[model samples]
Target: MTNRGRRIGRVGGGLPGIDRLFAALLARIDRGLAAGSIEVTLPGGGQRRLGGRAPGPGAVVDLRSWRALYRLATGGSAGWYEAWAAGEWASPDPVALFELFVANRHSLGDTARARFWSRLGRRLAHLARRNNPQKARENIAYHYDLGNDFYATWLDASMTYSSAMFEPGDTLEMGQAAKLAAILKRTNTQPAERILEIGCGWGSFAMLASGRGRRVHGVTLSAEQKRHVDAMALPGVDVTLTDYRALDGRYDAVVSIEMVEAVGREYWPAYLATIARVLKPGGRAAIQFIAFDPALFEAYARNVDFIQTYVFPGGLLIHEPEFRTIAERHGLRWEERYGFGPDYAETLRQWRERFDAADAEGRLPVDLDDGFRDLWRYYLMYCEGGFRGGGIDVVQVTLVKEG
Candidate 1:
């Protein structure tokens, strides 16, 4: 093991005594897992099985050291990731492990969540990265500004970043095109109508809508995405580096794809107000959003997860009931909601395959190193598992402004 691995293994200090504590922690986790199972290989060549009461996805995990449990007990998902990065544990299929955990989250309760001090520290850190105007730009840039070339290597030609609406026998590109068409249809706008796209990613929707003779305007915080969109220069399509709150001018219809998740729970009202404010009376807004199960939202919100920690700093999954209530408060009627969690799982799977291919074929950007690739891979797997377990979902909804 490397020096870092050795250090992680020594996290709780005293070896023989710590082993008993870690074993007790494992016992608690085993009792909580009502569905699915994990076969854990212990550090001292012993094997233990957890959660076989009900049949579900099964996983095999090799605990290389007791520190892996310590990290999981205190750090929650983020600490588990640290242990993985430091070689404290290994899994033949990490996705299954993640799926199992998410599937049994209710039964597990706080078994795998961050402890008091860790939760407080992470919550404070997340608060510091709140999505105010200035901080919002920084947060968006943190993820979306990772070079357009890097995303291009793995994303479909449309360059759409949100969940794709998949059909039978559809490729990723076909699914993405279908998603764009569905969102556009929800707008119910006629040709020559003006359309506004919030968080426009690479101008995919703008290009698609403008091709049909509609004037489309896109707003984004990522300079890289804006540059890419501007370079396209599709006729009737215009893009600017603008925050959603700063957007002005009324449009016939509005569309925001999976952008609300980054707004944070505190800013949800502001996001809906923007949508309601910009849409012409009787205009419809099509929004694609990812939401967490209501049962898990409180726990998820209390502590930062792996995605919030490493990928998107201030990100929060929507609590559907609360968000819908906010939309109603803004005089926006939320209607025609459609959810396809399995499709998102498939989408992530395809993206991971493409990313792996890009890495293997030397198509990824030269600046990205091994650690980044690993992190990206884990992100994809984690999201895929979350969707597969049905704890997280992707949905498209139409909100009609009160006329």
Candidate 2:
């Protein structure tokens, strides 16, 4: 029999009442492991044999604390009964632990989740101390400056690092190209017209626009991407390693793809105003982004920590209505909007494949491989589930400056 089944056998047969209790515990573990690996470690009260490795004393303690809190949150251990009976794992407070597990939505399989929680808790703790501008800059340089080549491995050719779902029966490349083309079409680009691209990653859109005989200027905070863009020097493309707030020129069209999220909640109005200032009156701008379900954010604050700390530092996602209101308040009128729910799932899957391919080819930093893989897997899968659950959505809004 399989290890899991063997474990299950220990508890399945009718036995003396005392023996039945032991069997029941094993049964729970079996059930928990049956669907997949049990990511969360068991509570301190349960058998330690099934518990995964604790990084150190702190992780174990934190988990134990969380377990207690979780049990209280979940109204007791009733939820874990089936798992205890299945012989996979056991927890004294199953309900609370399960509640916390699903709520975070970061854990993928068994091993990954445990490692993530441990590492994530550490990062959050680090953020609590020494989290001034210097540290923020250092963190950004470490993560975002991984080179355009590195990001290009997983990101779309345009390096639009937001949610993109594949339209029905569309490949990653096809859907992405369609999405980009859709953005260009919405902005009504014309030859010889000037366009500004905020947060340009590898300058793909700028290069493409230049190729089409339009003047395209792009801005980004990443010096790494700036170097790559400068090296390419495709005609009609101008790339700047600069901040959006520093931009001064007015353009016929402006596009900010997956960038606004970096504007923290307090800066939303100001950020929109800045965009309005640089956009010519009557000119259209495409603002494409991933937005959180506002209701979800209202429900919890810490739930967004993963995106803020790991993916985009100081980022805040808003609901479409809030975003539109902010833009309208800045004297911009929304012209068109589109949402791609499935496209992002397909995009993330492609990113995973490419990242894996690069890893297998020994192209990535050895020290970063495990973490990147774990991070990407969690990112991709959670996004897929989010899309599946409609917990999140992507939006492409075409806004024109009021005349």
Candidate 3:
């Protein structure tokens, strides 16, 4: 027997009552899934089908051990990931399963969420990783400072990390260019007017804006990113290693692409306030962000997910309505919002393909292990599935500072 199989035997040996509990839990999942379906092959050659009530994605899973379900029940998404890493479960296409779960999140309710004690523990752990200035820099380094070469292996030539705005027949590079153009247009700044880019990733927007005869100042917390940007030496652009809160100069426009998500929910007000403070009166700030459905925000905030646990330590998806309210409070008028969730899904799909190809060709960083690669691949698929499910969305909005 494999280690997972041996462990399953031990768990099954002295746990008749717990086995019944696991059965009940599986039944709850079946009842909760209002859309799509899952074909499950259990240990000991048992088979069970779940969901199938409505038309949606179909998935298949092989439960290597009942401990998988137990971990899921107690640890939520993070626990489920651990179970997968431990080989306690196997799925032919885990992305479809993620999509099914997110698509039916409303009906599924808390069926997939962490229990009280687990939720409390995870929440506390997340809070400890909060984005105070020092911690914020650490969090940024944890993901972005993985070396520019590491990202260049998989990302498009521009090294844009956020979701690209795709059009029919557009390559990843073209889509990213489109996104940058759209954001720059939203700024509506004259050639001579100054622009500020917060969390500039490798200076894509800065180079684009500078090429157009606009002076651009880009700020970032990641030293690696700053070094990369500095090396470019774009004549009309300057890159600084600085926090948004420490920004001093006033600009005619500000553009932040998918950066607000890094500013913890607690710091959202400050983020908006900084935008309002730095923008010249009547100037616009273009922001691209990912937001979770308002109805599900409360529950999501209560439990730490896989992304928060492993990928981006201090990250939180925006709750749009509340975020809009906060922007208004900071005297920034939220306007001209555009959502392209399907585009983000496509972007993720293409990125995953490129990442897989890089891995297959032995082009990824040599220092990174198989485990890290697997974690990253899983993260990409999980995000792609979330976008496909439609509960989470990517949006661009212009926030004009009130004069």
| Tens-digit per-residue lDDT, 116-188, candidate 3 | 9998888898898999999999999999999888899888999999989988999999999999999999999
Q: On a 0 to 100 scale, what is the lDDT of residue 195 in model 1?
A: 95
Instruction: For residues 1-403, write the lDDT of model 1, one tens digit per residue.
Output: 5211222232335666775677568778888888888887778665677878889989999989778888999999999999999999999989999999889888888888899999899989999999999999999999999999999999998898888889999999999999999999999999999999999998889988988888999999999999999999899888888888887789999999999888999999888999999999999999999999998789889999888999999999999999999999999999999999999999999999999999999999999999999999999999999998888999999999997
TM-score of 2: 0.68
State each model's C-alpha RMSD to the native: 4.3, 10.1, 3.8
Ten residues in a row with the worst lDDT in model 1? Answer: 2-11
State each model's CA lDDT, in order: 0.90, 0.59, 0.90
Question: How well does candidate 3 score on lDDT at residue 108?
Answer: 88
Please give, for residues 1-403, the per-residue lDDT of candidate 2 as tens digits.
Answer: 4333333222223445634554454344333332223333333333222222222111111123222322222211221221232333434433233323333332222311113444456346544532243444454455579766677766766676655535678766667677777777777879999888987877767776787888888887777878888988878888886666668878999988887766555567776887899888888898888777675554323332444445555555666778889999999998767887656656766777777688788776655656566565445544555554454678898999997
CA lDDT of 113 in candidate 3?
86
Question: Candidate 2: minimum summed lDDT over ten consecutive residues — where?
Answer: 53-62
In Å, residue 167's CA in model 2 sits off its true spot by 4.2
RMSD of 3: 3.8
Q: Give candidate 3 misplaced runs (Cα > 4 Å).
A: 1-14
Instruction: State how far residue 370 of model 3 sits from its true place (Å).
Output: 0.9
